[model samples]
Every structure is written in structure tokens, then in C-alpha cells.
Target: MESDLLIPLIWTVVFGILLTLGVRKFTKKQPTNKRWVRPKSTDEINKSQDE
Candidate 1:
């Protein structure tokens, strides 16, 4: 009975730690030119239509 509780408690702590680490990794700063980031230029729409 005690072992069952212990296993889940340990797993919960480990999972919480892992989640915090993963969140930190993703939230950290990176180069602004990364593909997922949108460009700041408002002229992009105009330029695209002219193409």
C-alpha cells in the first residue's frame, strides 16, 4: 500500500521538474530571424502583391 503511494509521488515530482525544464528551454530567447517569428515590416503585404 505504501509503495503504491510512493511510486506516484516520486513520479509526480519528476514530471513537474521535467515540465519546468521543458518550459524554460522553449521560453528562452533566440535569434529574432527564426522561421516561426513574423517579420516586423508592414510593407510585406504590399511587396507580395507587387510580385
Candidate 2:
């Protein structure tokens, strides 16, 4: 093939592979053993104390 065309073709394929792999990895489900908890904020704590 030609010289200039080869470089851009290689870059496109490499980046395309990376993008697909990243999307697949992100979409894969992960196992969870426990539920998530949210902590109370400082405002809530102050209001509770003042009441």
C-alpha cells in the first residue's frame, strides 16, 4: 500500500479497538455483596442538634 494511507489506517484501527474495549468493560456488570449507604451531612446534624 501507499506510505501516508498506512499510518492513518493503523491509528484508526487502534483507536477503534480501544474505544470498543472500553465501552464493553464499562457496560459489564459487577457483583455486589452489600447495599450502599449514604452518610448524613453536617447541615442535617446541626439542625437536629438545634431542635
lDDT of 2: 0.96
Root-mean-square deviation per candidate: 7.6, 5.6
Best by TM-score: 2
Error of 1 at 9 (Å): 0.4
Looking at model 2, the pairs that clash are none
List candidate 1 segments past 4 Å from native: 31-51
Q: How many clashing residue pairs, candidate 2?
A: 0
Q: Residues 1-51, candidate 2, lDDT per residue (tens digit)?
A: 998999999999999999999999999989779977898999999999999
Query: What TM-score would each prediction reach against the true structure?
Result: 0.52, 0.55
Model 2 stretches with alpha carbons more than 4 Å out:
31-51
Worst 10 residues of 2 by lDDT: 29-38
Clash counts for the predictions, in order: 0, 0
